[model samples]
Target: MKWSEVCIHTTNEAIEPISNILHESGASGLVIEDPLDLVKQHDNKFGEIYELDSSEYPEEGVYIKAYLPMNSFLSETVEQIKLTINSLKLYDIDIGNNHVSLSEIDEEEWATAWKKYYKPVKISKRITITPTWEDYSPVSSDEIIIELDPGMAFGTGTHPTTVLSVQALEQYLNKDDLVIDVGSGSGVLSIASVLLGAQEVHAYDLDDVAVESTRVNANLNKLGNQIIAKQNNLLDQVNLKANIIVSNILAEIIVQFVGDAWDNLEQNGLFITSGIILNKKQLVKDKLEQQGFKIIQVNEMEEWISIVAKKVL
Candidate 1:
């Protein structure tokens, strides 16, 4: 089979949203090339090693690449992706150069090309995200490792949004607590919640590919028995009350379900949300507050933000 590699030049602030656009447009397995990664200092406290190649990254804006099958609808799909990216301007997002290019490659070449961009990284104080193919050992007894094969899914569990979500989970989740992970892409957070001692996790994603990916990753982490993976819209008709409800999705989407999240949680239950750009921080905060949730903490990493709220009513 043949594949077309689609590359987009954009800024760091647009990474999360643009990646979502590409994923929704049927591109699988994203490879982000940010020049900052080359010079960024990574702490060695977690016993992780980095061997970055500066030559592969652009000196200015970042490059996001994804693989799409060479099919009859490829042209239409690419056009729609470009249109959606342009629409991001209304959201006050800086898209930078916005240059897009495409190239053809064989399936074998496309399969291995994305691996070079992924490696084991310590995303938070206790969570380390490693690709399924990497060999990594925990340096601390309390360290938690999540092994993920993103495949055609939208998450690698290493994005800043995902990192913030997992970090919030580490701080707020309690032993034997029931967790509902909305937009459970790759099932990373659900798996992390269980590893952090949650009694059981319910993982939901609207995308069938993401639902299957979560199930596969949960099984890979040996937590399949603890995580129930299913395809469901965000919090729609979800009546089961949980000890905690966590969502790492767009701030807009987050707000849409804030009331539902509050209603679906037991009193004093926690709501953890991320995938919010800095610009949307206060908007989400206000929405959560309007829904009777008290903001417990707000976490920022790079251009992303995560809000931890509790049901106090």
Candidate 2:
């Protein structure tokens, strides 16, 4: 299979409006990236709600989108989006009359060519990861280990939510605990939870890539049996009552799951959540509290925060 990419120039201020316009223009999917994220440094906006890597990206000039020929409207959609950019006076991502370009490449080239920025990341002292093709060893003396393939799956443990979820799992889990990981991205949290002591783990996510990624990660850890990865949305599809529930997803979605996450837990079961920006912390806290879950702990890192709460009567 071959893929085509459409590149446009615009400021950060115009990204969303442009994205929406492009979506309305009939694009199937979007690959949003910040030009500043190519650097290790970052800048915080909206209390980290608007995060930018803030140093420099290799091709610092354009924001690119890729889709099949069936979806080239993204280019025309973005072209129209630029007219609004002129009205808004945003300077961060100015393309200045640049034309969108298209390129064709083999499927394998996407991983090797487009993914140089993503590197393997470890969570806590327990997990160590090497790509499936890369040879690695797990120390028998250490606590947790996770192996992964290089892909777009959520849990390389690099995101704040994943790290926080791993830590939260460590704090509350016991060898006898039954854990459910909702929105289990790369099976990172599920794999880590089991390694941390959860007796059994049932992991679920809505995305097929995530389900397969989690499964591959499980195989990498040689724990194909410990982390049961399933392609589902929430716990409603599953039959078991969970002693712990971990969700590392966006704040908006967390609000929707507040009631359901509560329903799936065992009495006094733990609910761990991250993927919230700092400003939205209280918002999520209030919503979860309204569902009768008492906040147990909060971990904050780089304007990103995670919360662990327990179900109460």
Candidate 3:
């Protein structure tokens, strides 16, 4: 089989949304090459270890590469991805140089390319996310392991936004509590929720691909029974109440569903929001407040921010 690698030269701020576009367009796997990873200091708190080759990263803006099967619809999918990424500008997202290019490669080459970019990374105090191919063992008795196949979704569970969400969950989630994961891309959060002690989780995503990816990842961690993956737009019409509702999506989309999230959460229920750029942090905070949520915690990782708000009347 052949694969076409679609590479988008975009800004760091546009990473989350463009990655979503690629995932929704049926990309098999993704590789993000950010120059910051080369220079940023990594905290090996949980014995996290990984190496990045400077040559793989771009000199300036970030590079997001997605692999799509070379099929009849490949061209159409890439074009549609471009259009959707361009649409992000309307949300006031700085897309930067949105130059897109494509290349053909053998299945073997494509597989090897993306696998190198993912490795075992301890994203939170209690959780370590590693690719399925990596042989990793927990460093501590309390450490949790989340095995993810990025080929099935958009993230490896090590992205800053995901890290923030997982850390927040670790701090606030109680044993036997119910969790609702909005925009459950790759289902990492839902899986993490269960591993961290949630009784059950409802994983929702608008894209069926994401829904299926969530299911696959849930099963990957032997959590098929604990997580219910479904296709739904944000929290629309979701009547199931949860002790915690977690969403790691763009700030704009997060604000749109603030009311729905409030409606679907129990009193004092926690609403954890991530995938927010620094500039839009206050926007989300204000919306959550307007909906009568009390801000409990505000956490920042690199250029992204996560807010933990409580539904208090």
On lDDT, the candidate that comes out on top is 3
Query: Against the hidden reference, what TM-scores do the models get?
Result: 0.93, 0.71, 0.96
For residues 71-143, could you state the per-residue lDDT of candidate 3 as single tens digits?
9998888889989999999989999999999999999888787788888988888888988999998989998
True lDDT of residue 258, candidate 3: 94
- What would the per-residue lDDT of candidate 2 be over residues 1-313, giving only the tens digit for each residue? 5656555555443443444344434442345455544443433211121234444232554464544342545456556654654554342333444445566656566546534434444556566544455455665577455666645534346555666777778778888789888888678788888777777888897766668778888887777887888888666656678999898876666888788888788899999998776777998999998889999898886567899999989
Query: Which stretches of candidate 3 lie above 4 Å from their native place?
Result: 43-49
Q: Rank the candidates by TM-score, best first.
A: 3, 1, 2
Preferred candidate (TM-score higher): 2 or 3: 3
TM-score preference between candidates 1 and 2, better one: 1
Model 2: lDDT of residue 68:
39
TM-score, cand. 2: 0.71
